[model samples]
Target: MLRFLFDTIFMVKVAYNDAPQPWQLGFQDGGSPSFEGIVELHDQIMFYLVIILLGVGWMLGSTIRKFSVHHNQIVHKYHNHGTLIELIWTITPALVLIAIAFPSFKLLYLLDEVIDPVITVKAIGNQWFWTYEYSDYVNDTGETIEFDSYMIPETELEPGQLRLLEVDNRIILPVDTHIRFIVTARDVIHSFAVPSLGLKLDALPGRLNQTSVIINREGVFYGMCSELCGILHGFMPIVIESVSLESYLLWLSSQNSPPYSPLQKPHQFPKLGNPWGGIGTPSRGKRFYSTSSSSIDFATSSNEEPLPPLHPWFVTGLSDGESSFIISINQRGNGWTVRCSYELWLHTSDLSLLHRLQSFFQVGSVNLRKSRPMASFTVAAIDDLFSVIVPHFTNYPLQTQKRSDFLLWAKVVELVHSGSHRTESGLLEIVSLASAINRGVSDKLQTAFPNFTPYKRSLIEPCLSGLSPNWICGFTDGEGCFDIKITARGSGSYHQVECRFRLTQHIRDKVLLELFISFFGCGKVYIRSNNKAGDYTINNIPDATNILVPFFDKNPLHSSKLLDYLDFKQVVELVKSKQHLNPEGLSLIRTLKASMNNGRRAKD
Candidate 1:
């Protein structure tokens, strides 16, 4: 009997270590420190529950057997008046609860505390797949290692591959290292959960939610989306392979090599000199191929893997940063023809990202300049702008000064959609709204429409609450600045360093700048003396180091501005360490400052 019991326990343990097994009743064995703590807490709570259950059962049995009518016809006078028993009963349960609460709160706080992480992995949940980006490492190609992970379908599954739990790409991490996972959704809210690691975080649309883990052992762990996302939610599985640091570094090198398309799903992750060899075949989705630093060629081959669809909120986030809404008044034979269009201008380096945006909206045409590193994606069809652009921004609204522009631009798009742009009054209204968005009407159009009174733009109440981290990152990529100014104090040789993190917008949206202060809990809004612009600036070194640095370190910038930010952050560190007072550090600071923002572009 003892042998049978031991065999049963061993079989169960062997059956479920990293993935769910059929008829499994217990958790997969704890694979991280947090998971072990969770299991210990669970066992401790169960022990108390069992003790309480047995105590109650015994007391009830004793009462019934001792005071039954069949056993004794007379009732005892002391039965209803035992103060010691009452106190004991009341205090015993309270003691048990206090015991449970102490451990529960300790574990809760432990789980909530995020240690300084060595590596950061961003996981974006899509409708039926996952996209993972290693945010800390940028390869020689000037791109972070990013790829989509889709569950290998059952039809394509090999003999040993777990159905619905295997993904073409597994998130590779170094075991025994503090790793942070920043989870967000491109479309809907999905949960990134791994039971063995005791890691679960909501992948929210627009917003970023993060959790940290230290995988205790090296192995492949499997999890699935715990939240209902869409029809294919059940198929969205997560697979993570924790490897040694050396092996993980090799894998990173393989991923970052030249001509390796981030869009292409690898058939086999190079045997990373590890025990777990490789995942299965390439995923069926691929689209863009990088021809040069400035060009992205769409792969039209029959077997080319397709790319993942863009999330609506991601599109809105990019729009808030890099897009413009325009109202064009063209000179026709007699009267003017008003055209509404949504446009995005990006460097040729971001041509691939622009192409994805065009693919997402399914209406825009990407036009490139031959002589310059510039490309524009324009959606000019009135119907497409109304049907696609309008409803999208309406649903996933922009969270910046651009939100106001979108509101005004949307009104013009609506007028055009309703055929009101053909009328004289409608044309004037479009001209008025056009003047309110971006640079408003061009000089030519303003001269053409002499009676165009600038529209009294409705006040857009700045979104001050629940601002998505992604939206802030996007808007900052467009209008934010990280500046370091070093000046000599008086006539002395002493140099004082001023590190400021700023976001500027038109004076009309000063209230929007206030949102930055509220969101960051640091920084002040200062309107320019000319009253034409407003700046949200964090001038204090402590605020820049403590608040701004950590915030951006977690919710990172994806553009070239990220280089400026990195330089700015380094200068802030030098100032904090009082190293900027020295000639060597000061010279370093000067070099970094000179190579930031426009300086970086000029240097390139």
Candidate 2:
């Protein structure tokens, strides 16, 4: 019976040997003193424990000795006399504790210190898995590649691989290299910990925490997720292999392809219920609402016919006392053309207005028409459906030029598109106008009237009437006005000008100024010039007017009103006459011409 039992035990050992060893548990050469620092600290703690034990043992021995010597002979007890002894004992222990605490504090601070590392790796924790990225190390072409690490299952693991501990891919590192690690999570909280290296950090979703490590020895080490994140958390383990730089590089390249085959069957992940309210249903349908209060009844009776199609819309409550709207465009006809419109109710005309529309079926165009607070648009569809939206005032306009009104409007468009279901392809268009301005100005006029400045006021006040005379040339004194000023410079052949005037607010004021250089197109006005004579130069000069207009009918400058004021036309003639002169001379003439023309146009 004993022989049979021995044979059974031997068989069991052989069966266990057939199982794979954990990758992390395998022997490796990292370097000298691989765990010396931790070992030293542990030894120091053990030494202190031993010293305490010895001290306690000695005290007990002394008490026993004293008791044996005195036995029954002691007759008087004086508690007050022992005060000095009590003080000595108390102070000595306190001193020992302080001595221990000083080093402990130092060690803690050292652990917290995140030194400037030679390399940084980001570790993202997910349900029962971990993903790592070498964010700082990019290839010569600036491309970065990252991979996920998953544990190998017990049944398919190779020989010598430990069950529940072997991973498909090992974290490869160079021995003696300091590495900074950033930890984060994708869904729930997780922790990254390696006991041998004395490193542990929490990975919180949406937040990043950091720790550092330097492996002194080249070896494969094992670690497991320190935090209980899910049912499979215990199955997830970390395997790190530290090697020389050359070996590490080789291993890294080898990891381009995973060693083990992926699981044949799809992982049966637990269905996640509604985390916000703890609802157990995994595939709940989307809840729809018809009103902002979220109280509108959407339930349908069994006998009632299907309700009418719900027109989709989004309302964002803004910090300002107004809201905006977004409308989606749907493709209805056989061709790409599709039209959609919406009527907004307003209590007062004081509210601002904005619109955003998009299409999805096919690439198409958008057209917008506005009459006061009402707006209509037609979107040519490429795909199946399109969408549009309007939003309310969230912030004051142009309170600070630093605020990006256009970017904010873009976000509103995105919100509208994402809120709707569209099948067609189309373009998105956004138009915004303040309620106070009945007519919108052109891009050029807008550029000129930045911040609704004095120039804007000069033009807007007089041009509201369509029949305003040429104010720059003083052709109509109070009837019309124009204001022009140099706003910016560039390194090209032209300069930028801010132009504003009152034209009919309802009429399209945009005009293309074609430069008639002897009936030829000169390049648009640019601020920078190649003139050798260092004369007046402009950058980004438009294809329109070549002359500058500084003032309008209300305020005529004497230089502009004078016949011999060296206007742009006269300067051009003069430069032509001085063809033999240097480019600088020509440039000077051009500058004088631009200034005179600007002033003259304003007065005209």
Candidate 3:
């Protein structure tokens, strides 16, 4: 009998240690120090339960036998209740409860208390997936590492991997480090829980809840969204790969190299070091390639691996904001050369973006000008000028003052295209065309060709009567902006960042922009200055997130507008996550803001 009992106990112990087993009676063995404490607390509670059950069961059974009719049971003790018996009954139960409460309180305190965390991870729970942001770490090039971890389908699983639990991107962490997880939701509520690690916290929308854990062992731990978020909630499993510190650092270092596209972090990231050389570190031989699979746009890429293409419409929209076209008159030997140059400039921080843009248009050599904070891609070569630059603008036409310049510049290119620039007549025509270009003839052009009648062309009015999704998108591409305004509340960490989705148009088009207000089902059209172009905007968080976000998502804006929208969306999510309430969250919010529209720092 003793041997049998010992064997049963041994089986139970084995079942608990080997997790997720069928018919397991005990909890999975803990992998962290906190989890260890939790397991110990569970054991202690079970022991008390067992003791109480046995004592009560024995007493009842003995009383039944002694007082039964077969044993000549008698009625006794009619009038008086013993004070000692009452005291014993009340005190004894109270003592047991107190005993249980002490250990329980200790466990609760430990679970709630977050210790000094070396690293912070923001886990954003979406409808069917998890987006994890490593707020504390950046690659050698100062690129933030953030990624979305979608569960790998069964068909993609490799040998020895669990189905539905494995993910395309695993949360990698260094073992034996206290890591704080700031969990929140984007669209729905989710619960971030790992049984082995004894961690479970609700990922609430518009509410940031944080918990800390120090993984004491290295292994692949599987968990899932415990909350019933949506249809694919069960499919949204979490796979965390805990590794040695050195291995984790190696992975962190590799995240910045190749194939991954890095969004420029201009104002927020420290610009203390050289761009290629890295921020205060030696030049990492491998180049930085930011990927969404990371994170914050940086990831390691193999040389053979191809980079993703920029969407044509997106390129068009971005150009509408950041690009320029001009026909300049340059003083050269013997005669002034009429140079029709198309230049697109971006910040030095967005080096990858510039390269991507250059790759897309397949024209204009990307040049770095250290004197300016911006980098320029100029198409001075006449062949590239007509073939690439001119054709592109014609196909996807510009819609601003830039478009007016592009038209005059196109005329010059046409002359050059016709080889008419070789003659004196064509050269004089080109000079007149340059005078009519942007800002209406430079001071030098006026000085050179004194009393020269500037070539004049009527400004073409954009067709603004239409209200279809594409038309609205095109108009917004030129005239709209997604602005994230930050308001400081001294030292407090709440309500710091505010967002407004605005479209500006002349007051004459107040009725036209009002069409947008009607179409969006939110926001209002308000006249500013009673005459100048007014703002049709939605500034409230709920309307912006629920209404404006969905609209743009359906009729996606192209170009740099798309990048700005992405950053704007991230800020909306950060605010929703209640991240503004803490220092870490605030730091990350500021980092994201650095890459936002103009990185404007407006203090109120």
Off by over 4 Å in 2: 1-35, 61-81, 138-143, 250-604
What is the clash count of model 2? Answer: 89
lDDT of 3 at 313: 51
Please report how far candidate 3 places residue 301 from its true position, in Å.
29
Taken over the whole model, the C-alpha lDDT of each candidate is: 0.77, 0.41, 0.69
Q: How many pairs of residues collide in each model?
A: 4, 89, 16
lDDT of 1: 0.77
lDDT of 3: 0.69
Provide the lowest-lDDT 10-residue window in model 2: 285-294
Give candidate 2's TM-score.
0.36
**Candidate 2: residue 567 lDDT (0-100):** 44
Point out where model 3 deviates above 4 Å.
Answer: 1-19, 76-80, 138-143, 256-604
Model 1 residue 534 CA deviation (Å) reads: 1.3
The Cα RMSD of model 3 versus the native structure comes to: 29.1
Q: Which should have the higher lDDT, number 2 or number 3?
A: 3
Best by TM-score: 1
TM-score of each: 0.46, 0.36, 0.43
Q: Tell me the tens digit of each residue's lDDT in model 3 across 19-108.
A: 365686777767787788888888888898999899889989987888778895566658468899889879988998999899889888
